[model samples]
Every structure is written in C-alpha cells, then in structure tokens.
Target: MKADETIVNGVRIGGAETKVGEDIRTIELPSGARAEVRKGYGRDLMRAQRAAANGDASAVVFALIAEVTRVDGHKIVYEDVLEMDLADVMALQAEVIDENFDRPPQRASQASSNPDSQSEH
Candidate 1:
C-alpha cells in the first residue's frame, strides 16, 4: 500500500486516485500506534448514536470512534477505546470528529450566492 493509503476492514482506501469522501486518514497516536479512520456517513452516525444509550454525549462520540477507527488494521470495540490513554483518545476524537462532523467555512462568493447559507451565528 502507498504511504497515503490505508486498509480499513480489509479494504484499501486513499491515494491520489480516490474520490474526496472515499479517502482514509492515518493518525499516529501518542502510544506510537497508528489508527486508520474513514469519513463516516449518515448510517454510521445513526448506528453510533443508537449504540450510545440514554443520550449520553460522550458515549456517542466514543461509539462513533469505534465505528470508524481501526488500530493497526484491527477493529476495536467501544470499550477498547475507553481503555485507551487520554492523549490517544483525544487524537482519535479530533481526527474522527473533524473529518466527519466539521464543515469548512463557505467562501464569501459561495455564501452570497445562497441566502440560506448564511451563518446562524
């Protein structure tokens, strides 16, 4: 596999040829272990939310991590993520949440083109 590529659930992803959302991102943790995370879809988020009962926010984030993250190419459970070190967990959370949840700021021209795109803030 190329340096920019990663294998998630035994499927190869990333590289220059891949499309935007199909790319995989590699994160190196404080423990010296690397995790491969993929951009999650709506179904993945729904599954993670269901896994987190009682509407617990932290549980939902952790569940999302488990749903999209693979350490050393091995799948991990939510409990396994909870057992990780704080730094590693933060790193995982940043990568997973940013890639899946964070939206880039719209350019001035693009935002002006659509009145509905105005910032709520």
Candidate 2:
C-alpha cells in the first residue's frame, strides 16, 4: 500500500452513544498510530489567544493539552506526552476545540444559527 493510503483524517464519533460534553475525533498521526482524540466543551479561545499573545507557544500547548481527555480511548495524562509530541497534541487539541467551538459571527449566515436569536414568522 502507498504511504498515503494508510492515513485516515477527521474521523469523528456520532449519535447518542457519544458523551454529553466530550467530542471525539480520530486521526492517523505522522507516526502512523491511530489516536482517538477526545476534547471537551467550554474551551476559552480568548484565554488561549491571550496565552499565545504572551509569546509562549508552550503555554498554549500545555493549556490545550489539559482539554485532551484521552488517547486511543484510554485516559492520557499530560505527562504522557513527550516534548516532541507537543505538536501532535496541539493538532489534536485544535480538532477537539474545533469540534465544539462556536461558529464565528462572520461565519453565520442565518439567524437560526444562533440559538438565542428569535425568528419572526
């Protein structure tokens, strides 16, 4: 098989069997390992942006790492990630947050996209 054929990207869990606050995504890493990345709701994008503004990428990486609930469906602690693995974790973190983050104002085309907005008949 070609090298590209082994990789699968953006695999996600659907249906009621999924958990309430956590969103799961699966991807094949550069290392060729399949990881089931779990992320949660309520990630503060403002805070993350602030941390990045401080010019400390490591801070953003660590902060995002905390939101990762598991790897391969097993509980993975922050310590389990090696220094070289920070990039991988960051990518997965983005997936987790992206899966749950709200669509930005510019991205919304309909009032119905915003739950609090009332539509007139």
Candidate 3:
C-alpha cells in the first residue's frame, strides 16, 4: 500500500467524509489519562450513529471512531484503543463534540406559536 493511500475494511463509506480532516488534540481528563483526540465533521458522526442503529457496527464505529479495534482502554490515542467502555466513550463524546453532544449543531427549526395563524380551527 502506498504511504499516501489508506485502506479500510468493510463499509464502502468515506469518499467525501475524509475531506474533513481531523483536528488532533491531546486532552488529559480529571482522571489524569491523556486522550489524543481526532475530531471529524458532523456528517461522519451521523454515519456512525446510523451504522450503530443497523447492527454491531455501533460500538466499533461510533465508540472507536472507525478502524476496527477493541473497545476497552484507559488512554485513548485516537486509534490505539481497544473497546471503549460506556463511561469512557460517553465522557469522550462530550469532550469530542465540545459538550454539545445533546445534538448535532444545525439550524433549529422555527415554530409559529400564534394559534390564530392556523386560520379556521
């Protein structure tokens, strides 16, 4: 494989997803463990959530953030982690999304509160 070329198994996703490069940052949580964060765009995040809805790919894709690996670990170096526990992933997700994990950042839909605007009731 060429150094410039990357290979990912399964899931034919990410022709455009890769365009949004990661913003790498090393964060040390209150626990003292350093996390090497690799933040991607909202599109990728939605894709992962969708995958999780379909099958086992949820824990792998969403929690680990692509690249098949174990889900459990203390030091998350972006890719070195194997299995991110519930607590760990939750905490990281908050930090990853700037604590805006409540929902993806998008324009909120406006609602007309005036009942009279509805016309003949």
Candidate 4:
C-alpha cells in the first residue's frame, strides 16, 4: 500500500479528516496501523490560548507540542520538556480565528460611529 493509501475499518484514508473532538474515532491504515482522531487544531489552539491567558505555561507548551507533532507527523520526544514561543502561538491563533470567523472589511467611518443615536434636546 502507498503512504497516502490507507484503509481503516474497510474505509479508505487519504486526505485529512474533518470533525475532531473529545470523542476518539479509530482510523486503521491499509498497513494495519491505527490512528485515533482527537481534538482539532483550532480547538487545541483555543484551549492553549485559554490556558496561557489563565497563566498556565505548562498547558500552553504541551498543547503547542501536541499540535506541532500532529501536524508534522513527528514523534514527540522529551514531551515534558517541550517549549513554545508565545508570540508564535498567538500569531497562529489569530490566523486561525481570522480564517474561520472572517467578517467583510468595514468602512472606517461607519465602524467608528456608534449604532445608537441620541435625540437632540
């Protein structure tokens, strides 16, 4: 079987899968290797952001390492000693948020003006 061609429970695995969350889903490759789908990158990034905001450095680092490892398909070594740059994490979070929840660019004047109007006395 080719690297891209994988079979899981009689189903083929080629591209990335959608819908990842707390619930684990098994994916068996044609080579019989199994992988479980966990939380998505966006969700994991959000969780790390929350943890970092709450002053939990360890949580932030762990989340970052887990995210990078998952994306790079590299085995995580020295998991306990994993470190992450806060700026990089924040940038990635911003990118993900912008991509997922993008709003049309608003005119500057209209955006500055308040929606509520007051009656002149």
Which candidate ranks first by lDDT, i.e. highest?
Answer: 1
Report clashes for each candidate as comma-separated counts: 0, 0, 7, 1
lDDT of 1 by residue, 30-80 (tens): 999989888787766776777676679999999889878888977676788
Best by TM-score: 1
Model 2 spans > 4 angstroms off: 1-22, 43-63, 82-87, 105-121
Looking at candidate 3, the ten consecutive residues that score lowest on lDDT are: 67-76
TM-score of each: 0.67, 0.43, 0.38, 0.29
From the highest TM-score down, the ranking of the candidates is 1, 2, 3, 4
Best-to-worst order by lDDT is 1, 2, 3, 4
Clashes of 1: 0
Give per-residue CA lDDT, model 2, range 7-39, as digits (tens): 113321222223666556777756555667555
Show the lowest summed lDDT stretch of 10 residues, model 2. 6-15
How many clashes show up in model 2?
Answer: 0
Q: What shift in Å separates residue 97 of candidate 3 from its native position after superposition? A: 2.3
The reply for model 4, stretches above 4 Å from the true place, is 1-82, 104-117
Q: How big is the positional error of residue 45 in model 1, measured in Å on the Cα after superposition?
A: 0.8
For model 1, the local distance difference test gives 0.80
